[model samples]
Target chain A: MFKDIADVRGKLGQQQYIASEEIGTVVYLAHSLCKPILAEGPAGVGKTELAKAWALSTGMPLIRLQCYEGLDESKALYEWEYAKQMLYTQLLRDTLRNVLGDVNSLAEAASRLAQEEDVFFSENFLLPRPLLTALTSDEPVVLLIDEIDRADVEFEAFLLEVLSDFQVSVPELGTIHAKHQPMVLLTSNNTRELSEALKRRCLYLHIDYPSQDAELEIVRLKVPDLKPALAQQAVAVVHQLRNMDLRKMPSISETLDWARALVALNASSIDEKTLTNTLTVLLKYETDVQKARRMMGGGDDGGRHGRYNR
Target chain B: MDNRVVEFIRGLRAAGVRVSLAESVDAMHAVESLGITNKEVFRSSLRATLVKEHDDFAAFEELFPLYFGSGGPPLQSAMDDMSPEEQEMMQMALSALSGRMQQLLDWLSSGEGPSKEELEEMARRAGVEWANSPQEGRWVTRRMLQQMGFAQLEEQMQQLYEKLQEMGMSQEAIEKLMGVVEANREALAEQVAQRVGQQIAEQRANRPEDLHGSDLMHKPLQSLTEEDANQLRKEVQRLVMQMRSRAALRRKRGNKGKFDPKSTIRANLRNGGVPIELKFKKKKLKPSLVLICDVSTSMRAVAEFMLRLTYELQDQVARARSFAFNSDMQEISVTLSGRRAADAVTQVLYDIPPGSYATDLGNSLNTFSKKFMDAVDGRTTVVILGDGRNNHNSPRIDLMKDLQRRAKRLVWFNPEPQRQWGTGDSDMLEYYPVCDSVSVVRNLAQLATAVDRLLTER
Candidate 1:
């Protein structure tokens, strides 16, 4: 069941192969010991897809928590339904009045009001957020915390407490422990370095770009209708483009898009003509496209006539 | 499998392997799909997959075999086909050709060796801004020239010099071109050099630049420009080289004892000319260092240089271990394992993840004792460096005893200074204790004094 990352590597071309020895070893170790795997890499390098694939393989739903700059305890953990609390308060007023029947004192009324407030804000009124939901859910889940680097350092430190114990602490509810710990995955783009404390809690793996041959295989797999020659040509063009100092390098997804764009234009080959019209699929930024066009000796009019001008 | 190979190579490159895009494409078509998993297969696969540059092949071969761990009997069969003398000659030729080819490729990529029109076009691009002010134009031109990688630029300059000679250009013209190229090359190198030297200087100058935590705290803040930075770097390089040369010369000259009247009288009392006691002062300098580096992103490039400086000091300095800090601190002396200073620097900088926290100078001092003070003794001197912007983190003063108790002298190298110390979150005012000396370190010149102080202590 555990395919060696190298053996499986032989099945795909260099660029399309998603797993590395480092990544595979961590995956194998995570599965064996049931440790949470934390995959950190730059965006567009496929961190979320790996977790999704694992969930599919295990037949479990992938539970995602998209992290952002302002993610806080209430949003990530749990919060009470305030309207429900008010409705419950109204029902309790009528019931308690008949049951207790006038213990009429100002001090007693004040004390009762404070007691009711505590009851209203208790655990039963709380709504479970992704963390609590994943913990309490009946089925096994793959918990993915995407773009974790965007979150603040304090949040990372806070996450450490929950990640380490598979339990979270709430001021009103105390600690809610996980019945069965979900497979936790945290990804980052290395915007900032992670703390050693946070790193110690999970196995680490870094994902990077694919090689040309691997990329070629990926193109073939994703676009079977395209000619092998055209696919190879598009891969070659992408490879060349990667060498240039562009703002955003074409990703594997972009490579497929470029190929599809080439195919859709009814081009049998990736000649200079098709390249000019299809350059948009390869490069997103206007500045990047202009620079690439200049490099290829093309006109600003987006004409493909300049292919092989060099 | 073919597609998979391409993806895997790209992935490895993305992980910081420095694989070129062109090679990745070449590798894809070069190797047919194969189930080969052995070292030989993998090696061949990589060879098929990678575009081999001549000089790089040796390093590639070494790394390639090692990556797979015992890949078949090393493939030296290609060498076995020729006579020993012939093989040696061929190898030398290949090395030369490869080196030259790489140099040519680098020169071409750098926008040097462009056609005259292309050169004019590049100058015109700079000219657009030059229209506003001649000085700004010059600056733009210098920046454009600096945009090319230093290694690439230097190689291009060398090639240009060679071509000029081949064309029999006037000696004056050749020298002029060399000067321009050298100046431009120096500017590029200075960008990184000034950045590195500033930290060393800031530490020496005993000043840290203060920046309050606010929306207006511009980074690369009031820092040295690339040109000024390069000059400082050259100054540092020249100083070190001069020191090394002077030391060597001193050793060659042997002992030249100066006359001492007291010693002479004492010797005469003991029966002199006939027993004249000659006094000679020892010239050997004692060397010890304490490097405290800020590893925040703003200070990252500077931190790398300090790491390199640490590695360089390993052989020269008597006792040293470098520490890195952001919100926390870590001693990275263990990471400096290799021969090359740059290699050791990269290994440590890339491997050690700096934690997310503002500069906590006071806490870092407390941490030093727990992590490093035991290893230090009375002979060592301290060198503390930071922007002095403490970010209001807890300042633990009692722990400053590590510097007070163990160090022969504490040198707090503040990148900012007395003027900026108490302005913001900078707690430099609180760190006056336990410091035997403090300097405003902002350039290479300041580091010279710090180096001298460390050397003279012995």
Candidate 2:
């Protein structure tokens, strides 16, 4: 229900998510065009948060499908509740005998029983997963397919149908159409190249690590109680760490965690001692920590630093 | 405006960004709905709809402006900001210019560059359609600029500035007008050059003789330039994706495990113990690999791509330990894990600077067994990528033989052609019988096939 790109930004701000203009514009277009937005970026950026915030801002429910390897239609779309159907069939055996009573010929009894077969395959035995629920919802919702790259290639191909048409086919129920089209966002970590077929159907947004000013604003916004000067220095250091070729780049989530940790430790500003103590909070690897220390002009005796720097 | 967007997409395609028809239509719809009221929104709309790949974004950013920038500078009519008397002075100075110069003056003041059709016609007149490659685009663009008298226009603009002062225009007025003219001329030149070059590229892209990515496949790996190397870097991802889909279609046994009847029965027990839902045995625990690559200048291109594939498809392998050697050897698995593969290759090479240009694969293997013997186990596939020339150094097949005894599969990739094997002090034939498989990989296609065979044959 956002009126414009500015309106999207304003509404998302109400949800405490600071969106860049590019993100706002893309989200607005995806809404207007009824297209899925394929957001690709590094890990721990606010890709999943954007969908959550959009759902909150719009007062729609959030329907999430976490895709992974071996994710198939039975898991993602809809599954037949075979156990329930079997229980019902067992209970209805006497009724079936009564219905088939007084039929003389075997063929006649078989024909008579055939008329009642739709009972078990009806909507009562259908279990709708996230994809089906999103399509068949009576009201519009936000559908987030997270870590789609982790899904097998076949699963990605299967999604193309649901994405392009906003409809899905259930063998018993026929093709189900969306009463209200959901605003869908699919996020990828760029672990692999998505097929051209899938990319062609959706609007694309690449959310890289935020710029320094943006990250500072994000940290200050997300963690309100931190002192402004401390937040500034923390963001500055995280930015420096991001610039380094670490095994794992410290993302915005890590920055926020670092800030919260700094506050919890009662530290007001970053110093050599504090940085070394909290280094584990910012970086994951010992090699990465040593490299950061070396870059901080804090030389260590380990030979790993030599192999890394060279 | 849509015309400009269309040209922009074409220019993007010519620049090797794959903008499909569906994406192009989406871009158009995005633009049409956003309205061009805000240039930033318009740009974002186009980018989000048209560009999908992270790698293509750089191309999109580079070409977006060339198609969408105004022919002239943004300031419209520097004289309009002046007092009425100064405007009259400007009109008088403009009246003295003749024909082309006058038209050029008027166009510059308008801030709308020459029309697209006009640029197209000029490019055609310059015979730029004959240009069949992006590398040749710059040359043809220069020819088009020469034909358009762009060089003379710069000189004439200077003359016009002097004439304005002589005509008694105020110094401030003269300065403003001159600055606008110079900026406008520069913008105009850039506009023409980019458009002409775009046309040449489109011409080349449309031709059937040189398919976009296929050309790189046949070219010898040794002859690949740095630009070609970057292109190959991007292409490697596509190749892998293609192979993945193909493997899925064929149910490639190398990467995927076979049907699990036991697991299928166990899983389907929930449904009357029937086999309506069959399950696949999960792909065998991903096989670990040890890659020994030659980081010598001669093998740099092949080795970089090999690392690129590994970095991209890292999860496919359980654990990979990489070592780079020309003369001295260093374990680079940790180094490669620090960054993306493209930069990782350069980092590894920088870390282990080539020694004497001497390739001692034998000695490197000796060191590998001596210090890092624990890196290899029966589950590891040991792949050594080099020419096997060894620069006449000791070809200690004994070391290779010893390593082979401890490893699962010993595979050697010789980028040298089959005819050249054992031509010099190759040491290829000496180590050949001891190895399980030796693949002759002379070009990208061969390399891809060899890698495919090695990875899938297991």
Candidate with the greatest DockQ versus the true structure: 2
Q: Compose the digit string of candidate 1's lDDT tens values, residues B1-458.
A: 56545544543432223356654643443333323454444454454235222223444453342233331221112233334554343334334434545433333323234344544454455443233222353454454454433435556556655654655555565565455445434443333222222222223223332322221112222364553333344344445545544543444344444556665566555331343345554444444677777666545645654554455455344467778777677886655632234455766666556655566767777778777876567767666666666678776766765566677777776656479877767767777665777776554555556556555544
Per-residue lDDT over A1-310 for candidate 1, one digit per residue giving the tens place of the 0 to 100 score: 3454454333322334355454554554455445576676545666787777666655578889998865877888887766566567567877768644676887887787777667777877889889888888887788998888677556777888778788887777678788877888888765444554565556556566778887787778778889998888888888888876566678878888878877788898766778888899879889778878777754364344334221
RMSD of each: 28.5, 5.1
- Candidate 2 lDDT by residue in tens digits, B199-307: 6545644555344478898887778877677677667767777767765555544444678899888987877786777777666545678888887766665766655
My TM-score estimates for the predictions, one after another, are 0.43, 0.84
Q: For candidate 2, write residues A24-104 as lDDT tens digits.
A: 999999889999999988888899999999999999999999998778899999999977877787788899889998899
- Model 2: CAPRI class: medium
lDDT of 2 at B198: 56
Best by lDDT: 2
Off by over 4 Å in 2: A90-97, A100-115, A297-310, B74-209, B212-216, B225-235, B246-286, B309-315, B334-341
Model 2 interface DockQ: 0.59
